[model samples]
Target: MKKLTVLFIAFIMGFSGALKADEGMWLLPLISKLNMNKMNDMGLKLSAEDIYSVNNSSLKDAVVIFGGGCTGELISDQGLLLTNHHCGYGNIQALSSVEHNYLKDGFWAKSLKEELPAEGLSVTFLKRMDDVTQKVLEGIDADTEAEERKKLIGENITAIKEEASKDNDYTVSVKSYFEGNQYFLIIYEKYNDVRFVGAPPSSIGKFGFDTDNWMWPRHTGDFSMFRVYADKDGKPAAYSEDNVPLKPKHHLPVSLKGVEQEDFAMTIGFPGSTSRYLTSWGIEERMNVVNNARIIPRGLKQDLWKEDMLASEKVNIQYASKFSRSSNYWKNSIGMNRGLEKLKVVDSKKEIEKEFTAWVSASPERKEMYSDVLSTLEKAYADRGKDLKAQSYLIECMLRGTEIIALGTRTLKLEKALEDEESDEKVKEVADGIAASLDAFYKDYSVSTDRKVFSAMLELYYKEIAKEYYPSFYNDVVIKKYKGDFNKYGEVVFNKSVFTDQKKLEAFLADPSLKLLRKDPVFIAAKSTIKLYKELYGKVAEARASEAENNRLFLKGLMKMKSDKVFYPDANFTMRLSYGKVGNYEPKDAVIYKHYTTLAGVMEKYEPGNYEFEVPERLIELYDTKDYGQYAATDGSLRVCFTTDNDITGGNSGSPVINANGELFGLAFDGNWEAMSGDIAFETQLQKCINVDIRYVLFIIDKYAGASNLINEMTLVK
Candidate 1:
């Protein structure tokens, strides 16, 4: 770790951190850094042009964005796409009940006809992209205020989208990359009405929930299956029972050949955001304060909520998604905090600052520029502290509410009704809107969610912050205000309080006789606070944007360092292509990931009593029989491949790990233990990615799952 930091420090100063100098190398800036080139003789072959030129037209056809969900890719054309099971867990859970229990039973369509249609799911592909930075940032001057700049960017994007899609079957979106300096208009064909093809039980999909999240030597089969659907004409359309299977222009072939160390591999998918370009102060704040003080504590509340849910079946059914969501972030924060700690990011930052200061002392001109840059960054970090507590509170407050989308729908109906002049028309529209909204609101939102969040918020306030910072007698006031009046807050939130045994909440909402009190003071205050928080959130977003621009300038330097060195900008949750080969890693003192896990490990980790890692009897039995056929490994596991270096993050889950021939060899699941810090700092020495070998996934589909009928649709190379 010391050497790691020292090497990084030397690189930062010696290489001048010039963006262009390392161009066309495997060492991506932030989104993903190139893995240690153990196979290429510690050399990088892929150029910036190769990376930037990769597109739908360049890669195998099987890779597709799961669309409307997290990123995923098609490993086989026969509708056998592999994605992080958690990504599809919601729909799986949504379709499951105590009777069906897909999460427990594991859904295998058995046949194409049996594949279930997921109501709101969709898949999208980026057909093309054109740089539109000039248009998006056009006419913007140094004097442009944040709010005005945002509005202008929005207006320009709208216009660009309209013009770019003039003769295409795709929808156009203008994206900001490198902050506001670079923009790309992405044209995509969105296919709605994707169906749930299959999935291993939670035991296979999410084995080891919180207990094993973000840890390596992992044995989780976090894969889900879905199939895209379209109208009979093969065009994007709304959900219909009669919708036909989508015929894609490109779908990657399953690579039975496997990925060996440093074999050329790449994943073209949407990788969410990264702030590798941020100053050391930014990383320190995330590590020491923002993520630790705020995210971790709130995450603990969710854990508590889940524990509460599991204790009661009814609560489990109601707050399942809330619990799952909370757990996800909780695990991520844990990993993030650990990475920051292990790397001693704050210490590293201080060292870098000291070195830079000393370097600046050698030259007057350099000293002035260095001072100005540090001053700018310091001011930004200082300003970020003012609203930290308030912002954290705002998230907690919203977590205890109804579906925002449903709320938006309700607001729209109310606005329309208020605008209508005709009594009958207004009545009809309002009634229909209200009736239509009932199921979406009731089914999607859990009443316990609000209870859990609100209680957690209260606890967080007390547990984390200083009492003096809070209003005088805040605790006493809350207790007094709600004393013997349980219905007050409950009625405002869920029209009733499921968290308590209060029967008066229903009476309160329905009582027309006391309608004036319906505008409860507490409810009104909550609403006003929510509105103010939202407005403040917008300002925070703008401020973050300004800081992002400064960071981009730093990154841009990396790309422009020297000619002949091409650079693929690190991912920003936009589609990116990272090419590498299958490989094992040697993390300090001979820790190695020789081969990937198989279906056997799925059963090995299963604990019948533990919901997080429990494997079902059927899956265990299948694994014991060596049912993998051709995909079976000599090492005895399912034969998933390993990689030493790749840049990926949470959003990159289910991204297709393609081979040099552009065949789908593996579905990227997670990064290795050493690479945990890759999210914050890309250490080519430490940043290795773990991918589920495509062969294992295919074997599951063809043999155990019995969905081979779908396999006929793909163009299999082997």
Candidate 2:
């Protein structure tokens, strides 16, 4: 393969055409050459360099990868970070209990010292990016065997990543693009000392709960604040009392100016994944196999969790984040399947495949290069269907359905150290880590709750999947020992397993016995489940390889066949800029959804003592008095949330919505339900990015919380 020069990227991305609407998640390094002119024409006041300059502190410096998959931006020079409240749900829930339930009631730190350090929370900054296609695919021609090609490419990527991160502590990754036709090397700097600052209660932050998620005219105040702390030398460090708040290189100035219809708006975020170029067969498999797995098992598990949560506040706080995490994707799967069928996406893709097949047949060279592409993809998807379903079920039901399996898996590291006859100090290190984490794990765990979930999920797996795919223990222990009753097996396991009780786990850590752990019921069951998953995955590995290569080939051919069409690579969890305008959409006939929703809408949905729609008394009093302070629109109405056409998906949950100038106006949180299929297929007219108005965030911070010290930290732009 020849080098994909920077000039080539500019030519491909900078092309002028109207192939589609604003349907792109563009890489920033080439934005100046590709999108600056179009962005300026759409009312942008800042240059591409202002948005993404690696040499100087720019807007990219302010944007960080919050937690694992979400995007966050620095709001003040003190490294005060702003992200979606849902994105911070796990951390808040972890720190909550019946005594101080931050998820039920709100939380605010009056001063820096009062801010609580969030465990397992880290923020990552993109240091720089480079086009490294040539470096990654340096070896071989068309004659190279597929396995050899994969092995050589892996070796090449490892070498490039090692070389890039050799001199600095920055993490490096090489991401493929255009379906492996291009590659980019990204460098990131991570800071782990992130502290929880403030958040509204679920009543406000999660106003509508499950019903309002992925819906339009949203009134949720989905915003949260955190502060990044570093060592005295301004270097990233572990949490410590001596650490100080980081002085960010650049921070976004808050804008009180409200959004208007057709106003230019943009969002930069780390969108997780998209299958925009997926084949029809793949789509069918996704809907029937993969998503079906998520829908059925998760739906069952969430129901069990909700019952316990509603019965007791303790269980509610313990499983708050767990339930939210599970339900978010469960609902998304349902909506996506419905959207895909409604839109006839499979039929449309079939039409495209027909076109590609005819185009390939017209020329001998094209035929030789692409004749088997469709057939190969079709066969791979067909072959992997059963195994894929089994794999997905294994993950949702056996692996993630219950918490005990994950807990059991965590002990493997200590087991491995023990088995290898490593140094006593090494074994002690592993044991100590597990001991320290036991409190945190059991803090949110409930043996009864998990035992119920365990029985139901395993039953579902047994009933749904083929008998051949059952975990080895299920047939042996569940059938022979427990008369095929998963409930009986589950009850027995939880009753006897050391992992079920914190004190038992602590006792194990003290003794450090290998024989006992090997005999542990939970460990034995987890190992069996994991072993089945691995075996299934290995069975479909070849099909996966074929599918991937064919997908890449089909895309490469499609790009060349339609050279004049404007195309942007699918999102791969990288920092990308998507430019669009703030606007409303008509979800159906005779119903035009408005661009924004105000506080009155929240009040309209309010019900007395209702879990989902209950209004706080202080908020109601503030609404009655019309005391919105400095955060109200000129018409004396306080807007809660708004909508935009900016292209975004799951990992974009906490992205910052910026105006024409480089100032924050809203926080991007969810996508409207009408466009749930946007990830697989961009719904140009119906898709909308739902965001909480920045003013509402400020209003809650000032009047509701009265944290003036926190307010003073920001540079608000009037």
Candidate 3:
């Protein structure tokens, strides 16, 4: 690959090499050039090519983009997969029901025949990657207009992606990097038939639940198992009885040898997003507008969901995934806000910006190139605050928070089809698609719980957001008729709307008519809300474009200004490797947290009737008997979870924590609460990757659950 361009180089000038091991989510393709020597210095035994090689079966082959968002690793020749229990929580909940409540209890498939099919779940392996920045910006220059630059880049990406997948069945994507100053092409091979093999129940898997979700000194056994299947010829295929377990190119050798403080620890996974390059204005917007919207509405909605879930097993099974998904980030937003404030992240960013400004003012050439970058970004963000806040509240309060509104939004396609006077066959195709989805949707839906969510979320939106951001229905109907009582309006809509009842919806779809659909109150609200959101999006688009272009220029110049220091690209759901040492941190004055937690800690937190801290009976029995088998540390304690300084974010969940010899010792599940602000600003001293000890995973499989079949298949190292 062509090296980065620069007008001049200061050549380190006493700069510390490569931003330390504890920071940076680095690209694999650049590891050898940028990070190999440093990694080797940190005690890594494997070569860079051993970890990521396009031509050979390397560690990359063992990793997959689990489902849509998290990471998973192959553990056995039979295609057995392992990831965080919370990462697989949604699929597990989808497979559960009141009759066979796997979420409350647990599931263990004794043989291949018994593994449950995870219908919507899929695993994707990265085939390779290529640098395509030169191609993407071939004809672009300083004189090019913003719109023209965007169009040319888009065309170049399309051509690059087309040529990359010209004669293959691979999924190829061209993603921008370094704030669109550079780009890369990623290729992936996706398999559709993934099956659930085993998992510990919530008591163990989600031991601390929300109370301890993003906290440290965690004792959760947060691991789950799945298996990928393919056709006899080893090609990706749909779920079928004839399909056999995949014989993967590589699989991780699980290590019962365990981990210790200061040992080499590394993770390779797809981290979702980070704003390490984001300006101070952006940080403020993230904290006040985006997080506030989520905190206020989601917390209110989740409380309602939790009440119903506690009252009935059916409701619990139905809403478990939804609640988990909502609460995970709701609590995250809370913690992130707290961290940002406590860490003074905004002031830190502003100081950097001030330094950048002074650097630019020194030279006329630099002044011309970077003069308006900061001002442009400041004005862009300042002007769009109201629109962004309105959009965030709109999304959290109605679009996502209310189940029935989300379900109702699905009918827009059918509505458009009928309005456009499409052919009967074409309309039937659209209607058939909606009808096919209903079974799965209604399977895990509870009308009573959804109605409560609808009422609470709608009331919050109406009272909190400005009138101008309100949907058409609130002014046209609610204000005029119900005196702006959101609960009454919600009740009327739920009572009369077919979207609230599956049978009624199916009947409406049986002989669907445009007139009847328009008459529905839920439909009106959904349509209006979506239309307003689009309008809000449009209002912010221009400012967003200005901000994006300026941000790109700012980064390009900043890289130039700090040419001696190595810079890693911010995360954007791409495979990245982060290495650090396994260690502990002192979060506060005179209080130090240890590097790891154990089964004894799990027992200490156990309360018989407490939902969040409840320990399963069988797990308690094993702990009392000290039946940890061979998974215990040298001191005879069963290590549950440990901490590392490896930089990670949301999507890094389920990443395998490999040791110096490249053997799996832990599974990265959560990041410690002290460094929740690390996504925006890496906290080297306080940031820690909370991981579930792989030995604990083995112990649970071999001793607690008696699923020795899984344990026997894995290649364990002592």
Best by lDDT: 2
Across residues 174-239, which tens digit of lDDT does each residue of candidate 2 receive? 999988878899999999999999999999999999999999879999989999999999999999
What TM value does model 2 have? Answer: 0.97
- For residues 1-718, could you state the per-residue lDDT of candidate 3 as single tens digits? 2234322112322333748888989888878776788889999999998999998888889999999999999999999999999999999998887788888898899899999999889999998988788788877877788899999999999999889988889999998888998788999999999999999999989999999999988999999999999999999999999999999999999998888989999999999999999999999999999899889998898999899989998888888898999999898888899999999999988998998999999999999889999999999999999999999988998888876777878889999999999999988888888888899889888888888888788788888888888899889988998998877887899899998888889888888899999999989989988999899999899899999999999988888787767677899999999999999899999999999999999989988888999998888889888887788899999999999999999899999999998899999999888888888988878999999999999988888888999998999888
Clashing pairs in 2: none
How far does residue 172 in candidate 2 sit from its true spot (Å)? Answer: 1.4
lDDT of 1 by residue, 269-319 (tens): 677666655568788667666666546555656665676667766556556
Clash number by candidate, in order: 37, 0, 0
Model 2 lDDT at residue 249: 85
Model 3 weakest lDDT span, ten residues long:
5-14
* Model 1 lDDT, residue 217, Cα: 59
| Order of candidate numbers by lDDT, starting with the best | 2, 3, 1
Candidate 3 local Cα displacement, residue 82, angstroms? 0.4
Selected candidate, larger lDDT, 1 vs 2: 2
